[model samples]
Target: MIARSQRERLLEAAVRVVAEKGYGAATVADLTREAGISRTTFYAMFDDKEACFLAAYDNVAEALMRRVAKAYEGEERWPDRARAGLAALLGALAEEPAIARLALVDVGAAGPAAQRRYRAALQRLTPLFEEGRDFAPGGRSLPANTSRMAIGAVAGLIADELAEGRAEYLPGLLSDLLFATLVPYIGPAAATREVGGNE
Candidate 1:
């Protein structure tokens, strides 16, 4: 196979370094050493570690988001769509624990700009959750921030697992996540029923 470019190597290293040592502790030297590139090359590719990390974070988040959107496609019901989308996310994260941590848990500790990116990444999922409002009978009665809150609930559940080094078990959370995603718009009885429905 052809060799990866320096920029790609640096971004990969950024994710690895952050996953291993976290953003505050990971240094430029650590990134260079991990990527097997010189400091000069690292600087040439990225202005700094944060820039490199943000790029990697965005890459991982976007890929995961795309997987979820694709999984949700072809499903007419909102709950099925949410389940498919969430299952896709959990499976992807389980396959790459480091990227999972980097995308959710580590990004929070990466400083203000990284935090902003994390928020933006989470916001991108709102449209997926917002569709529930139209499907639920009590959709009009739900609070205005229901979609944002539901997204937070799902993210919180996943992030909790990642922070505890239980990324591999994320797929098992499908029911709980589905409940959280649906509970805001639909009552518990219906959310639980939907979660327990046929795959």
Candidate 2:
């Protein structure tokens, strides 16, 4: 097998170490050791532990976005695409709980840069949420910031599950999350049917 790049190894190691030790406690030495690379190699790719952690966070977030986007592809309806994307995301988190925690939890404490990156990721998702606007009641329209708030609320809930060591239970929240996201636009009666229709 071909050997992995030093940068990839370092990023993977950073995700594992940061998830286990938290960004504050994890060190460059720990990252290099976990990656099985020399300190020189780590420095060659990243300026410091924070930089490596930020890179890892970006990688994780990008990977998740790709999965969600792919799942949303070829779907005619917004609710169908939303369900598909949620399933893809929850499935990914289930398979990579450590990286999930690293991206969702540890990144916040890593530094202001990481926090900004997290906020950017959330902002980027607003359009995905906004796509459902046409499904809302004819006269009832959501506010401009409603998408961000819904995304933030769901992110907060996912963070709580990860914090409680119940990451595996995240998929179970899909219906409720989907309901919460679409309810404002679709209204209760339609939203209830949309959420429960899948069952």
Candidate 3:
């Protein structure tokens, strides 16, 4: 097999180090040790540990977002799109629990810049949720802020699940998240019906 690039090795090592030691306790030395690279190489590749971590966050978040987008594609109905997207995201999280914790949990604890990246990552999903407004039953549109909150709510729930080492169970949350996403626009009865079909 071809060897991974130095940058790729460093990012993967960063995720592992953060997952094992946590962002607050992890250091450049630890990351370099995990990557089997010298400190000099680490500096050559990244400005610092935080910089490397932020890059890792972007990498994981973008990859997961792409999966969700792909899963949602070709599904005209909103609920179908949502179920597909949610399942894609949860599957990714379950398959890469370390990366999931690094992106969803440790990134926020890395520092202010990481916090910003986490917010940006979460905001990236807002457009996906915002689209739900258009398909809301009766041509109803949810408040713009509510759509944003729904995105944040899903992130927060996922973060909590990851923090508790429940990443493998995220796929089970599809219906609950779908219900939450639909509730703001469609009333309870309709949202329940939407989530129940699971088509």
Where does model 3 exceed 4 Å of error? 1-4, 137-141
Worst 10 residues of 3 by lDDT: 135-144
* Ten-residue stretch with the least lDDT total in model 1: 1-10
Query: Candidate 2 regions off by >4 Å?
Result: 1-4, 138-141
Model 2 gets an lDDT of 0.80
Candidate models: Cα lDDT each: 0.87, 0.80, 0.81
Q: With candidate 3 superimposed using the best TM-score fit, by how many Å does residue 117's alpha carbon deviate from the native? A: 0.7
- Model 2: pairs clashing at backbone N, Cα or C within 3 Å: 136-185
C-alpha RMSD by candidate, in order: 2.4, 2.4, 2.5
**How well does model 1 score by local distance difference test?**
0.87
Model 3 residue 37 distance off true place after TM-score fit, in angstroms? 2.7
**Backbone clash total, candidate 1:** 0
Clashes of 3: 0
Candidate number achieving the greatest lDDT relative to the actual structure: 1
Give the per-residue lDDT digits (tens) of candidate 2, residues 1-199: 2234777877878888988888888888899899999888778777888888888888878888888888877576898888888778788987888878777776778778999999887676776778877756562356777788778877887888887888889899898778777766677788799998978
Q: Give the TM-score of candidate 3.
A: 0.89
Number of clashing residue pairs in every model? 0, 1, 0
**Per-residue error (Å), model 2, residue 49:** 0.9
